[model samples]
Target: MRKVDLLDELRSEIGVVSDKCADQVNDLYQFVCESLQKKMPGYQWVSIYLVQDYAFVLRHDEGERILPQSIPFGEGLISVAAARGSMVRERLSGRVEVYMPFYRGHHLIGVLVVIAKRANVIDEEDVSLFMELASLFETKVEKYNS
Candidate 1:
């Protein structure tokens, strides 16, 4: 499928997420991880890591999980996105991971990490869509947490 089609499919999936689920952020993360992994087989790993006490703590992950509980403040791709306050995509050989920083208002709170085996799994447009999804996730959090 084309990138737009894939993204639209994801958008449709997430669009139906009841606003009530926002209170359970970990559950919300799991739901999204399962949804994306099932819909897009190329997606090898889907996870969310929150910035806790100056460290990137692994909050949730789905499928073939092997990441540590916490990583150094400025290590790995997730850290790069957090430090730069923007999205960062890394490509190596035939695998790729796109890290997008998730914000709680103006304050950066966490990072959304999407991994795929295919070399061309994502592009600029997809990054934009993913950012939209991240914003949606944050909105849900804000509504639920308030």
Candidate 2:
């Protein structure tokens, strides 16, 4: 939204972060989700789903509503996004859910789900920003996991 100008700042916020946890990748995911929700008020919920064992496993989430901890490979919007390797924007009754898939090389890493309380909240610029965020998340995850 209007926070587009905060791109560099947001990037820097997530780029140089390192958490001392057993599961650092998930910790980074949680940090990114929190940062997104705090910086973008339009995002009522933010969650990271890692592709593990052919399923979308919920690594971390920061939001008002609780979500499923896991989704089967071919069950829902996450599956659709993963299949296409692109962002899937869905407008529901009261919210707009954007499922953005990111990768490490040709391998799909995970999906970043951002939910806004109002419909039509995601636009072209937002999509671009989300892609950048997903790339940053992928880089951080790769570095941490390796």
Candidate 3:
């Protein structure tokens, strides 16, 4: 499917989930993680990490490999993205990691990390879509937290 189509589908689904489960932000995250992982080919891992006090706690994820449950501030790429309040994209030999930060108003709140097995799997368009997705996630977060 096209990237815009995928995002539209996700946004619609997230709207439904938001209407039904407005207080359960984790469920919304889970739906997004699953939908993106299944619909978007080449995505090896899709995860959302929410800020909890001093660290980022894993909220929802869908993938084959295991990942850390939490990451502290100023530690890893995820934290770097959050601290910088911007998206971070890293391309390695075989994989590409995109970390898109989410915020509550002006304060950083979380990060959405997408990992693809190959560097070519993600491009500029994909990053833009992910940024929108992250914004949607942030909106839901604020909706539920308010």
Candidate 4:
């Protein structure tokens, strides 16, 4: 399938999955991982890092395993997103880091990071889709925390 079609499918599936998993935390993470694997085939890693006490804690992840699931604000992609309250896409030779901020009103809640094998692969469409997905995840997290 074309990249655009694949992205659309991912976005639609993410929305459906988010709605279906709204009441459950594990389900939401599973859906996100599945969607990322389907949408960005070259992504080597994907994770959701939540903001807690002004820091980012890795709440969920897929692809390569990572330990120490927490990082201070301004340490990595999650921190960058949380600090800026915007999407940050960076490409470095063989790797790509895409950070999407999750916000409820003006408060930044978390970030979603997609690490791909090929640099410069993330596009505008991907950013838009990621933002939508991040918002869904944010809502779920907020509801779960409350």
Better of 1 and 2 by lDDT: 2
Q: What is the C-alpha RMSD of each candidate to the true structure, in Å?
A: 2.0, 2.8, 2.0, 2.4
lDDT of 4: 0.76
lDDT of 2 by residue, 86-116 (tens): 9999888788899999888789989999899
Number of clashing pairs per prediction, in order = 0, 0, 0, 0
Q: In model 1, which regions exceed 4 Å deviation?
A: 1-3
- Cα lDDT of all candidates, in order? 0.78, 0.81, 0.83, 0.76
Q: For residues 1-146, could you state the per-residue lDDT of candidate 1 as single tens digits?
A: 97679879788767766454646777777777778777777788888888888788888887666467798887887888887888889886688888888887877778888888787876676678778878887787677767
Output the TM-score of candidate 3: 0.87
Clashing pairs in 4: none
lDDT of 4 at 130: 84
Q: What TM-score does candidate 2 get on C-alpha atoms?
A: 0.83
Estimated TM-score for each candidate: 0.86, 0.83, 0.87, 0.83
Error of 3 at 110 (Å): 1.1
Model 3 Cα lDDT, one tens digit per residue, 74-101? 8889887977889999887689999999
> lDDT value for candidate 1?
0.78
* lDDT, model 2: 0.81
How should the candidates be ordered by lDDT, best one leading?
Answer: 3, 2, 1, 4
TM-score of 1: 0.86
Error of 2 at 130 (Å): 1.2
Q: Lowest-lDDT window of 10 residues in candidate 1?
A: 16-25
